[model samples]
Target chain A: MKQYLEIAKILKNTHIVGPYWKLKLSVSELAHRASSGQFVMLKVDSDQGPLLRRPFSIHQVKGKTVELLYEVRGKATEILAKMKAGQRLSLLGPLGTGFSLCDLSYVPLLVAGGIGVAPLVFLAQNLRNRKGLAILGAQKKERILCEKEFKATGFRVKISTNDGSRGFYGRVTELLEELLAKDTLLRKKAFLYACGPRPMLKQTIMLSKKYNIPGQVSLETHMACGIGACCGCVVQTLTGYKRVCKEGPVFAIKELTEEGLAE
Target chain B: MTPNLSVVIGTLKLKNPLLVSSGTFGYAQEFVDFLDLNILGGIVTKTITLFPRQGNRPPRTCETPAGLLNSIGLENPGIKVFIQEKLPYFQKLKVPLIVSIAAQDEISEFVELAEKLDKERLVAAIELNISCPNVRHCTKKSNVKLIAQDAKATALVVKAVKKVTTKPIITKLSPNVTDITEIALAAEEAGSDGVSLVNTITAMAVDVEKRRPKLAMVIGGLSGPAIRPIAVRMVWETYKKVRIPIIGMGGIMDADSALEFILAGASAISVGTANFINPNVCSEILRGICGYMIRHRITSLERLRGAIMC
Candidate 1:
């Protein structure tokens, strides 16, 4: 609930892969408050082209620095990608529900698609003390992220590229199925966590239900206020429409539907 | 001189003229973590309905150039829940609480909501939201898409709610109609203490490549810099038409934009879409207004309110 709106100075914004960039902001008040799967609402530029702040997952928080991994998909990110170091951007964060790390003995199985690895990288970093695995999926090999970071964090890393250029020849869910089926110990003790495209997340939910494994997934959509006030960033749950900003940018897999929540 | 920023809308005296527009600032508790709640002139709660609303389907919002399109469909916990669950929390916030209410299609529904909230001691004023554009079934019987679009409908609802509640009634008007003064005058004649001018103008955007509209509701209300001129114009027109005070809001992002509304004859202004860009925008705007007043050597908001030399 502790949210900070700081003029965070960008220390570095480096290109990681296709359409992906790693941005590091020196805003300690927000960075230090960020948990594993929480996110931030970033104002990429001053009042000009884009009017609303864009939401980004907390990629990592090192000391006083908060990291973000973003894709240049829209006008906001396009403006964000061209910016340099020393330039300051407005940020509101350590916002939203983060991944629950309560199970001390369960193995953390992280699943991500494209730039969705942003929050899971931070989650994996938080779970460094425990044995875990990071599975990343990309349209192709050029878009894969965080293999080295996950490896450095003492977690196993796996990748799946659509063109069969990397770890697996299919989707991340297929790879998840492979791992969950072959490894009995992992199947019993695994706690699945995912963040990615909607279809991918839906498949993850089904996989979790089919295997009876508990997990959480981060939800993303267009939002004006990164707080619960706007009620614009809501996804239908069993309970009704829940704000992705308040109830979660992260939600229990059980709350998700196979398709759009029936209005 | 710091310039007395205080302005009164009906019986409600705001410490400043900078209020956070409804729907833009949730119930106000959502902002407790970002900035001091007392920094605001007033906090207008999201439009409350007779029953809980799930709102529009997914893709509720889209960012257009210099503006935001939202089809939130008045998503809110019903007045009963607002009284029980949301009203108590506002009692501790210190800032004046103005509850905005919307009735689907009945004058009685607005009266009922006002009657229920009128009993609450924490409520400072009641804002009748007759302008929301995303809703359809509510105004279907009247053949008007929105209540505020018709002057007679606007006056009747305002008068009905006014009779049921002792609190000052501020009727919310929309700019989607051809002329806004007609509705503003009707509210004033029907017993409105003040009018909150220019709710979001109806607008829409489309995804050309996908051949799909940007918002799930297809058409949504546009609120931001893009609609500021129109809102200011509506306020100016309404100001000339009615004797009642005007609570101007439509994209007042900063002190300058806020000043524009005041100069256009608004007693106070509401900061809407800008709060999404900066959580601390309300505080920033208050500071900017103080700085402007100091430079102008103005002593009170009375000197600035409707001070524009046309």
Candidate 2:
């Protein structure tokens, strides 16, 4: 069911996992209907200040509360930074095609980079007894969050940092390669899923392909509507032009082209 | 029925005045699946020309303090290709479709495009664009008589195209003019069935780092709520001067705002920049109007047109 929600509470810094912030909103209508990969469009103003609403992948939904994660960057986000807790925000959601884990039974190897880790957090929580391996990356050790939670939930967590400030001093893709090389049993049956910066995802796709494993990557694009309508968030795939919002922000590794990954 | 929302532009009756403006709405096909296309009065497709255009390079759109700058440069598949390749998609849509056309240097280009599409019964009307002044010599040529230039040019194209087809012709006016009524009068004088006012006002955005223009085209059209007040004034003035009909549009977001345009003398209205911020804006406005009608004990939307208090 589709729902239009008003931002009842803009809870800042709810500390969901690590250094990441959890924007908890009171959106019962949208929260109750959202699935794993569905996202929402958030508006900061009635005028056209942001011009376009920012699309956020639904991190977690429980009862009437919905959550989103974002890293502040440009002017639009700067406005979001100043928003008070009680301020009302216009939200449209439960959009885009979400992840479908309907009838698959293999160990899931999930890779996340920086803020890209946001979407994977809830997925990890949802998968209780499934053997899940999550490799997380950040610039430093302090930036990493939720290691304890993943471990408590039975996910073997692997951490990497770029500045040599934590776990491995290199990228997380290297750690993924190491995992595949070391565990033949895990490599043979594990299904790969990833979300992060474009470069990291590109490398992960390459590594997964080299290891002969099936993989899916979630993409983020500049979007007007979080649903398939606008065609603003189009990504070039092996088949043709597909909207990231509708076709699948999460696409199989084989379905992508160099242009798709590069964008 | 107390009559609250509907309006008419000449002989065409609209359920409500709200429509998606050109360019921002793309083709109705792109959004029809997500929205009830029948709920809107109409949708103005992105500007088309005699030839296909690739448009400008990205970052094509950037947010200003209260608006957006777009240099989309009329990226469409030419009129011939549009009629042959794209017109069929509108068959599934419930509302009427308006085709917006633009040219850089000549009135003949507009005439040629209108003539080509005139034979087909797919589109309901044509919107002639004379407000895009940054595209080279068009500024000097179209600015000579301001609104009359568009009216006269629109009349010629309408007359020529009418010779072949019977669809309505609407001249879309730019907001940069000193006097918009003069242009509105000119359009009525030139045999235009209706007029859509006002198109985006020409404006510029600056990138602080380079201190240069933000858009690739140097200057772009300013749209969204920032231009709403200006549009309402122009529509009001044009309403006083014109004998035909006017499709008022600029920055309509909600039902109350949409009502303002009608009260100011708009026969119908279009939602331009608001769609960018909210994909469901068209449906939202439609529902909002329905709710307002029930609360006010109003029935037909026609009574609300031009009902604003002085």
Per-residue CA lDDT of model 1 for A24-132, tens digit only, reads 8899688777898898899877557787889999998999999999999988898999999999998888888898884987899999998899898888877886879
TM-score of 1: 0.97
RMSD (Cα, Å) for all candidates, in order, is: 1.7, 5.3
Tens digits of per-residue lDDT for model 2, B1-310: 4345666665566666777888777777655545677888887888888887655544445556566666656666788788887888888766778888877556667777777777667677777776654354245555653333454654655455545546677778888777888777767776778888888778888878888777656777787778889999998888878778788888787877887787788878888777766666788887777788788776776666667778
Which runs in model 1 stand beyond 4 Å of their true positions? Answer: A261-263
For candidate 1 chain B, which ten residues in a row score worst on lDDT?
B136-145
Query: Residue B276 of model 1: what lDDT?
Result: 83
- Return the lDDT, model 1, position A6: 85
lDDT of 1 by residue, B1-310 (tens): 4578888877888988888899998888888877788888888999999998889887899898889999999999888888889888976777889999988767678899999889889999999898888886355467777888898888888888887888989999888888889889899999998999788888889999889998888999999999999888888888888998899988888989999999899998999889888878888888988998888888887788777897
Error of 2 at B310 (Å): 9.5
**Worst-scoring 10-residue span by lDDT in model 1 chain A:** A254-263
Pick the TM-score winner: 1
Best by lDDT: 1
